[model samples]
Target: MIGIATFLYIYGYKYICKAILTAKVMFMNNLNAPFPLLQSNKVKFISSFSFGFFVFVFLYIFQPFGINEVQFYKPLFIGGYALITFSCVAFSFFGLPLLFKNTFNPDKWTVKKAALYTSFIILIISVGNWYYTATIGQEVISLKHSFLKFIGITFSVGIFPTVIFLIFTEKTLRKVNESKAGNITKQIHTDLEIEEEKQENDIIPQIDFLADNNSIPLNQLNFLCIKSEGNYLEVFFFIDGKLNKSVIRYPLKKAFEQVNELNNIHHCHRSFIANFDQIEKVSGNARNYELHLRNLTFTIPVSRGFSKDLIAIYK
Candidate 1:
């Protein structure tokens, strides 16, 4: 009786650990952002049973002690083991969706509610285990002690793996937030350079408004920066800064050449060109800068290579 009880306890404990470690590896493989874990209920169930069976057979074959008791009806023992393993695996696999649903929509389960749910799940598993043993007519080696041992095995195998998964998910979220912050800083820097260029242009003396035979003033044209749908650039101009702008489609380099003639054009970033006269202030540290304009704010970043030029403009 003592040997049988010890065997069952050891077998159950090791099987539980194997199942949990397998689940953890599966969770890690499926960590593909926004979908942290896979939704394959069938795979999870199969994996659990396979892990349990593998661990059980490995332990039985490599019996550390000399307590090998040959029993008749060996097939019955194997079948019973398979049935128990499948039941445990299926229960865990089906329950996983509930965990994910709670994680994705936190509003569904408050801390208190989660605690209550977890307790209910544990209770169900414990009662189910007892009922299963009773129906099979298997007497526990030491009922009082084995019950506590079973609880320990279940927690170590199941709950510990879930906790580890939660930790990994939190780390992923932090990385995402850091990436967004970097993009925001870059945008702010671009807007600042545009404002600064506009201000510089305002200080320049107004040139004579030369009118062609059509009475269109060439010197009074307004400047605009237009981003193309893809790799094109278009510069728009409005005469007297009040008329509707006229667009000239050209490569960005060519547009830069035309703007250079006016003495106020600057490349804010690879993606933006700015008129410096509109710059209000350069805020934040040297690594990042904010450009404030009339009712708009943009970011301009000063790389180590461009820092000198940025400072020269401000000075």
Candidate 2:
């Protein structure tokens, strides 16, 4: 009986550990997944200030907190909501990311992340509102009794618009990029073909690509772009019409130095040096731009500093 019980306990413990490991993996996968978000500090600043104004306008118009019953100056009283909102938003979107750099990377941003972040901000807003209600309101109100009420009101008023607007905006931007990227990419392919024909006899320049204890030549490889990834550059190129990539131990800044003579190749992003000949189209407006490369799954982001340079080359 004792042997049978021991066997069952060990098996149960092993399965429980396995299940916990699986759950942990799933949770980490959601958090660490590389989700594309084109947001920057500029975007966050705009959103934070805009949300504060929205709160001001919302309170002024709605008067939801029985503010009509209060005898104090209404605009001055309601304006506090705006300040509270602005502070909370500025902290959540701007300050939190700065403090928690490892957790809030834009490259790995996810919808779940946005939703959770929005919810967290809203909760803080609710707490602020609750404190305001307790300290500033007319009657002697019991704090615990009305705390949940304030939370409910805050979430109802804020969450729907904030979360939905974010999701909608992301979806809309992606659609525009997808629609425009395909057309632009096709045109680029055509342009490359024409340019290839024009430069058929031109001598393709050869440059040395730094590698692990050696150098690699460029002319033989036909590399389309190079991406710097932690002491290695991921080099993309074509071989007999098939796309391929080669990883080399090199720095992107050095690669740009070597390829300066190549007019078609430009260091378009901090992490990327792109051959404009292989770029399908430049996406986004003057404020933000992205490069769609030929036969590549992801679009390369073009930082503001490099946008003018790329636009000049493309034109």
Candidate 3:
């Protein structure tokens, strides 16, 4: 049982590493975009330490190796723990970034694509672990027993936890984005009002039509709205409280291009971009700002770093 478990663990880990590396190489070579790679040494070290501690605690409690018959503080025990920790750290340092690099690229993977990739990776890992465990042992266990054991381990320790984590993270990110958007809207509106009063004119400067593939006539634009469509963004200007509903010319990264040039336009959140001219009112607290734009109300959050900028714009 012990040998089978060890083999499963090792095989699962190696397969995950290889899969991630392959994905990373493919993304870098095939897709030429400036996406962030997963190369955080600090995260790798911390994860390794945590994994090692968990393994140590598990072994200590279970005494799986009949530690009561031998010295618990043996040199072999320390060496084993060290090896596991180092191996995990090394693997994560190389593997995680590779996976992230491939999965995070806007040009390469859409939300559906990313989800499919994750499912495939998980399936491969689970099956690989099961096969390794079933075949490694000398004692012949029934196929049913091995299958059931594999299912139990996978559901309890792998799939369930990962799914829960993803759900929680997604919820948190949504809230954060909403709050940021509200704050940006408020700031832009306040700035616009001040500028308007000074100039004594209601007309806001609009972008002149440029004969470029990227250029859009300012006259054709009405209200800038940023909507999140999974990993992609849907950008359209509202016409009389209705979505103009034109196809987005660029991805989220490109949509944000030259945003600084638009004096009254700013990205309120990762999922939302807004125009100050469209904002009707600002409500909510420091952490959460709500914007009333015509008939629509949206929340924008103020991250700690952007708080000063937000305040300055409003003031």
Candidate 4:
């Protein structure tokens, strides 16, 4: 009996801890079930053991199945039988998650998986119970006559309880998902309102450019510069702490007019427009007056005609 208890305690300790962590993340993350110590394996094992022990005690003391429950004679003495029964019940509850981990996996849960898991656990428990009764209880079993009797007894213990638990679990999960969806929608709306308020108070302007069916909104302060590429213009800007660009089919001369209202912007070259306030350094003279801008890796060419205007803005 001690050997059975020790074997159960050791193996149950190993399997239950890992099983609880996986089940909590997979099956209970958003649902927020009230088992706080599910995150700790030691606590989970103790909880399972204690609860299982109490339930077995209640059933044993009351003898719910009466004296001749299955073809087995009543244990004229239950002290030894009660201890073994408690060990089995505790082991069953502690190791249950390990048995059905795949069924509760967050990414792939379904009604089919739940039903399959229920069947597998029931089959295993039935076989286990048959062995326990044959070995430890006062039940004499013959290969010929007791096989069907064992099946009938084990089936009664395993099936209905599992089906009831599965039904309650599925209904609870459906309600949690619906509630979470409503909260997520409200959060998105609140974020959009906050962003609009910040844009209104910003010192630099926000530019809205129509880019193929999408509207790309660029903050003026983070707008590095733009360079004309034949019929297209490559617009550079800083967003999410990264330098990014978009190629749009707009004429450079026409693009300049759209942004001319901004005081710090200047047409520094026939091919380039510079945001003067963003310039970190200006080098070279007349022929090659290169302009280096903050947060930009490359320099912009300052043509002879635009050199004086760019230099004046830089100083």
Index of the highest-lDDT prediction: 2
Per-residue lDDT for 1-315 in model 4, tens only? 999999999999989998999987876554432211122355445643543454345545665433335345444333333344345544544565577665444334444544454455445545554555567553532332255564564455444444444454444444443344344334434644665588677676666755455465655567788899898889888888888888888888877876665656888888998776566555552123567788888889766556445434423
Give the true-structure RMSD of model 4: 24.2
lDDT of 1 by residue, 244-292 (tens): 4333334566555545565455765555555544444444331234344
TM-score of model 3 vs. true structure: 0.40
* All candidates in order of lDDT, best leading: 2, 4, 3, 1
Of 1 and 2, the candidate ahead on TM-score is: 2
Global CA lDDT computed for model 1? 0.46
lDDT (CA) per prediction:
0.46, 0.71, 0.51, 0.57
Of the pair 3 and 4, which is ahead by lDDT?
4
lDDT of 3: 0.51
Candidate 4 lands at a TM-score of 0.36
Winner by TM-score between candidate 4 and candidate 1: 4
Ranking 2 against 3 by lDDT, winner: 2
lDDT of 3 at 177: 44
C-alpha-based local distance difference test score of model 4: 0.57
Query: Residue 159's C-alpha lDDT in candidate 1?
Result: 66
- In model 4, state the lDDT of residue 232: 87
- Check candidate 4 and list the clashing pairs: none
lDDT of 2 by residue, 185-211 (tens): 566777778877877777777776666
